[model samples]
Target: MGSAALFFFLEPDNALLSDVNGDLVNAFTAVRDHPIAVHNRLKKLPTGSDSYYKTRAVDPDELPPLDAAARFIYLNRFCFNGLYRTNTAGKFNVPYSPSKTGRIPSREKLIEVSQKLQGKRILQADYAKILGSHVRRSDFIYLDPPYAVENRRIFKQYGPHVFGSSDMEELASCLEKIDAKEASFLLSYAYSREALDLFGGWTTHRVYAQRNIAGFVKHRRRACELLVTNIC
Candidate 1:
């Protein structure tokens, strides 16, 4: 559910967007419901190491929905590589990144996003739960689960218990269920042995994407990705 970029691109009249990250989902909801307020709040936040760390230290839960959403967006804009990582205690611990431009989205852009999200169901739930309970015949599902490569330590954006081998097994099971329901689905994941073994039988396509997981432009590299689909 990273960015839900496809959803925004397609702008379907009816769709259900979900993610395991509740804070992200809450931010989306806030943007949808109170774009002007969130935008105003974002305008007041200063962009500097001192202000960034001070805002980061404040618990988002203590703020109202609009303020929390603003803080989330602010942190994303100023944090390292726009990464969302947390410590074992579930506190956001990503260091302030001075290299970032630290520019918030304009009010017009926020309003546009809010308009796109209007009337759509935004949920904070695991993929399995969303697929199990909400999938229907003829529905189109796009799955962009976190990259869980074999024998590699990927950046933990979503926290310690990121996608793992067992989660891949669960994803395979979910694919079967979606097929049985006559729904079309697409999956994007890192091109690796695990991905090939699990999804090679599907209509798989290999693609290369520029990955910035290294958090520096000099270290960015093109990485292979697998696009698996059950569409005819």
Candidate 2:
């Protein structure tokens, strides 16, 4: 959600957006194509724990596309830290946080975002499938894969799949191909010595950042991540 804001701010001429979480695609599409329906439905859902839990139980496929998208937005805007973690059963289990308000995008904002998406292709596919051999030197790819958490205690792992160290190597190999084709690229990941060693030859930097994890400014602390690129 944070990364996707770049497009909103910059208003890119074009983009090919995708994510492994297919529900997000549905929500974005709904907001793009049926803003009024989603907006009206979102207003009717009770902004409470029971509503949150019940909405989570509704299978996305069972609901109307517009409702499914509203469900996704409702859960996301109403969850703790806006986290997208799910249980082993693939059920969204992020408990209701006392901090969050049950807010959904308004119709006008949805219309604006939808308009921006007009010329784009929103997909639910793997990175490699999206970045095929058709890349050209004029292309610039920005990838945000799972962070390279060094220790089990240092970070919270989420999702059905684990992107271990081997996956990092695989990504490096993939980036090598992109670089070979003369396409520029950048990636964000956990800042670690291994990441530096893994991508030594490419330009790299440590970016200091912060996240409001506890719904308070005082709880925000210094954080950093690696910004590695193969762009000249």
Candidate 3:
């Protein structure tokens, strides 16, 4: 989210938006183009368990493109802590939050966001594939891969098992190519020895982020993380 804001501020002409989850990418494209549709759909659906459960059952692929995007937006906005998780059957199973009322992005905001996606490339591919082919000399690449920390793994896992030490190693190898191409890059990761070892080069900086997503109120506090870059 922060990266998107920064990129638009810098006004890059082209970009590749890649994610392993095709559903999310597709829904985002839909919402980007038809934010009003998302807003309208969400408004029509009543808040509470019945509506949330019923909406969750609707298979995104089976629905019209706009409806599918609305489904994705609705769940994220009203689900517990806005965490996207799935069951063994790969269905969204996050419980409806007692909190979180109201609609998602305003119609005008969506229009602006849709305009941004007008010429940008959206793909459902691994990071290596898109970044390998598209990134070139002087291109800026930002990696905010899910952290592999043990205790925090359960909450932070974007997928059932999307990231781990091995995945981090693969990403590190990709950095080599980016370096060879003389491209500038920045990656954010948790403060851990493994993170340091995998991304320890060029320059490193420390920063803190509030742990606002913890399930328990007591656990909500600031945690340390690192910013790694290929520049001084």
Summarize candidate 3's per-residue lDDT along 1-232 as a digit string, tens digits: 3125455676678876777776788776786677677668766777778988999988888988777777887787787776667775677887888474334666777677787777787777888887778888988888777777666654343666567667878888888888899998888788888878878875899999776555556656787889988888
After superposing candidate 3 on the true structure, give the runs of residues whose Cα lies further than 4 Å from its correct spot. 1-11, 154-156, 214-219
Query: Which has the greatest lDDT?
Result: 1
Residue pairs with backbone atoms closer than 3 Å in model 3 (clashes): none
The residue-by-residue lDDT of candidate 1 on 106-129, one tens digit each, is 999999999999999999888899
> Residue 148 deviation, candidate 2, in Å?
3.1
State the lDDT of candidate 2 residue by residue for 1-232, as single tens digits: 2237656676778777776677888887777677888889899888888888888888888888888888888888888877677666667777786365557777788788778878776777777767773467768778877665576322233456635656788888888888888888888776788888888779988897675543345535666778889865
Backbone Cα, N, C clashes tallied per candidate: 0, 0, 0
Q: Please, what is the TM-score per model?
A: 0.94, 0.89, 0.88
Q: How many backbone clashes does candidate 2 have?
A: 0
CA lDDT, every prediction? 0.87, 0.74, 0.74
- For candidate 3, which ten residues in a row score worst on lDDT? 1-10
Evaluated against the true structure, the overall lDDT of model 2 is 0.74
Q: In terms of TM-score, how similar is model 2 to the real structure?
A: 0.89
Between candidates 1 and 2, the lDDT winner: 1
